[model samples]
Target: LHLPAPTDPLLRALHDILRTDPADNRSLDDHGRRIGASARTLSRRLRDDLGLTYPQWRTQIRLHHALILLADGTPVTTVAHHCGWSSASTFIDVFRRTFGHTPGTRPTT
Candidate 1:
């Protein structure tokens, strides 16, 4: 995803929310409300600014958090829960797709 820098107020706010709380699984509607935009407008702005839809962007950010948790020796189940995955299986599937390996293959530090 070719994301633009967080220059817009809405983008900056969204970045802050994602950075401070990757566990936040708010829908596009909820996020738009926080930024004073309709979901449609929010979608356009996100695509224009970030080159991805809300859900796609959220997944990317959540996976980033998942990686950090995994690197810190957190259990996969706990990491899945913390990252707001519906189930460990789902989390593993996403992790595998993104990283080309299952969470169990993560190197212990």
Candidate 2:
């Protein structure tokens, strides 16, 4: 299944949380607590309302921010950290997979 339509309220709330802390590397339970929802409820809501699992959605959020940071001339290592990646290598791998190029290859704006 795909993500919820852009107009979905659930997507808005999730976007708010993500934008506030794009580097948030917290567990699903921690995210649930921050939003005043139980982990199970958050999981269910994401699945039912947004057609996404927590990690899947978070990865998309992180990658989007990574691109922005890279374009703005943030160091690739710093972008990795800012995007909540455990390591720069992992970040490079995911960035390459998602964007078809390594983060280092992106021309800075």
Best by TM-score: 1
TM-score of each: 0.86, 0.80
Q: What number of backbone clashes does candidate 2 have, counting pairs of residues 3 or more apart or in separate chains?
A: 0
lDDT of 1 at 86: 85
Question: How would you encode candidate 2's per-residue C-alpha lDDT over 5-81 as one tens digit per residue?
Answer: 32445456666878678887778787766667777877787787668888888888888777778879999999998
lDDT of 2 at 86: 88
lDDT per residue for candidate 1 within 33-108, as digits (tens), equals: 9978888987888888778888888888788888788889999999999988889999999888877779989545
The positional error of residue 93 in candidate 2, measured at the CA in angstroms, is 0.6
Location of the lowest summed lDDT over 10 successive residues in candidate 2: 1-10
TM-score of 2: 0.80
Q: What's the residue-level lDDT of 21 in candidate 1? A: 84
Over the full model, what C-alpha lDDT does candidate 2 score relative to the true structure? 0.77
**Total clashing residue pairs per candidate?**
0, 0
- Report the number of the highest-lDDT candidate: 1
Task: Assess the local accuracy of residue 44 in candidate 2 as a C-alpha lDDT between 0 and 100.
Answer: 81
